[model samples]
Structure formats: structure tokens, C-alpha cells
Target: MNALYHCISKYHSIPSGAWDALCKTLTKVEIPRNSFLVKEGMVCNNLYFLEKGCLRGYYNLDGKEVTYWFGFEDNFVTSFYSFISRKPSVENIQALEDSALWSISFEALNQLFDAHKDLERLVRIINEQYYIRLEERFMAMQFKTARERYEQLIENSPHILHRISLGQTASYLGISQETLSRIRSQG
Candidate 1:
């Protein structure tokens, strides 16, 4: 509710009327710990607002789960390529804890975008922000030292150490649990 409104307002100046209409279309869902919000090979039809709890995006590779992104409270969580392309998701978005989420269907969002220019602009901004963050993560993995990547992750998500498991955090940083342990000890 308020979190959704705040997220939208952070990017654009939307009218109360638009928020009222948007609220009418949004559904609140509770996901349990260790459950998948958007499963791999399933089409992601809705975009999620992470009102509470945490979600990690991961995919299987070489029989192992590789975590790539973690969405925390107030962040948007969705398999964007799947959501936009209307294809099955390659990654799984999993709840790390009991979570409260607000979801809007693809059709409902399109309708809102058609009716509200502000909301449309907000969506564009959201896409651009996601792209920029993704680029940073990719460059870090390809070029930055492991320690630098770990430091950047800590700077980007200050509460991540408290909220996330070390193994998952290590995977996101493209490092091993032993490496993470060494890094933690060095700190």
C-alpha cells in the first residue's frame, strides 16, 4: 500500500486518482520461506513489489544454483525478460523469509500505462534503473577483484549481511563460501 505508493512516487509524480486505480488492480500475496515466487520455466505474468522480506533470483547451471540478484524490502522483484517477452523465466525468484508482496498483472499494468502517462514514465525509469544496476553487476563480475566486488555488494546493500546467507551472498559475488569466510575474517 504505502510502500507501493512510495516506490512509484520515488520515480515519478503520480496522481492520487492513478494510485487509487492502481491499488484497485493490485493484489497482496504472502509467500512462505523457501518457496518460489516465480519459478524457472514458468512464465512470469506479474510484477512484484517486495513490501517485506527478501527474494533471491537464481538459476541452475552445471547442476548448481547460481544466485544473481537479491531483492529486499521496497524493491521491485520480477523476471523482467520473461515478464516483458511473455516467455518462461530462466531464473527462479525465491522467498528467503515469510514475505508480503503486492503484485500487478501484465494486462492491468498495460492498461494503467495507457491511462496514466506518469505511470508509464515511472515504468520506463524503473527499466532504466534495472539496466544500470545490472550493468554494474556484470562489469564487477567480469573485471573487479573479488574483494572489491564483495565491498561493492556491502555498500550497495548494507543490510544484506544480516538478511542473507553467506553462501548465497558468495554466489552473487562470484566467489566461494571459503573465500567469503576468508573475506569476513579479514574484515
Candidate 2:
């Protein structure tokens, strides 16, 4: 919880009353390994602050799961488009390990936004950060070779290789296990 508070404070500081109100709306949730926090075609009604463990967000492409991103402790997780638009999500968010989270419903968060302008600014900044990362990923996918992508991933997020399976890492890097193996062996 303190980590969550610190994360929020780093974005923007809200009034104590608004913080209390926001805290009151948060609910604790526990998800076991390999379980889903959200699934395709479901409306994501809550935003989660991960307290422990790891999660992955992915889309199913012709029966294959293509991982887009991962979230670990002290980070907020949500199906952003679905949460904001109240539409069904095309992606799934799954727990990689036994995870604990603090969740706030869409309605509760919106209410907080209405009541606290600072909270809204904080969310906007967070969304901007999300978009920046998304663009970086898009550029990497567009311009970089598979080997370069793998190298960039290893350089930027080496912890991912340690925390997830090689198969999952390969999926995230937009490569197959064999290709990843070949590249790793070349190093």
C-alpha cells in the first residue's frame, strides 16, 4: 500500500480527503498463478495496483497468444481502452505468479476524478507514460530486426528473462523458441 501511495505521489499529489476517499473504494484481490485478471470480450471494470507478483497482457491471434506487455509490483494494471470506453476487451491479463492487488472500480475512479482534479491529472500523466512506452514498442517492432528486438528487451528488461519462461519471453520478443535459441547461442 505504501508503494502504491508512493507511485501515485510521484505522479501528482492529491488532497488527503481525496486520497482517503480513493482508498475507501479500493478492494484487495488475490489471484493464483496462471489465473486471469481479465479475459477477451469482457468489459474491464476495475483498475488494479499490483502489490505482489507478476502479470502479462496479451492478445490471442489466430489461436496464438501474443504477449504485449508485463506488469510487476507497484504498478497499475488495466485494459485501458476497455476501462475508459466501457467496451469489451480483446486482450487478456493473466497472473504469472500468486498475486495480490488493490483494485478500484471504474465508477469509483471516475468519481474521484470528478472530485479531485489532481487525481485526474495524475491519471492523465500515467496514461501519457503508457502511451510513450507503447510508441517505443511500436517503433521497435517496425524498425528493429528480431535479434535487435531481443537484444533491446534483454538490455531494457533483463528481469523479464529471469521471471518468465523462455517461451513467454520469445513470444514477447515476436519470435519463436527456435529463433530465440539460435540468437542466444550466437551470443
lDDT of each: 0.92, 0.92
Listed per model in order, the count of residue pairs whose N, CA or C atoms clash below 3 Å is 0, 0
Please give the lDDT score for candidate 1: 0.92
Regions more than 4 Å wrong, model 2:
none
**Model 2 deviation from native, Cα RMSD in Å:** 1.0
lDDT of 2 by residue, 1-187 (tens): 7878989898888789888888899999999999999999999999999999999999999989999899998888999989999999989999999999999999989998998888889889988988999999999988999999999989998889889988888898888999999999999
lDDT of 1 at 53: 92
Q: Which pairs, if any, clash in model 2? A: none
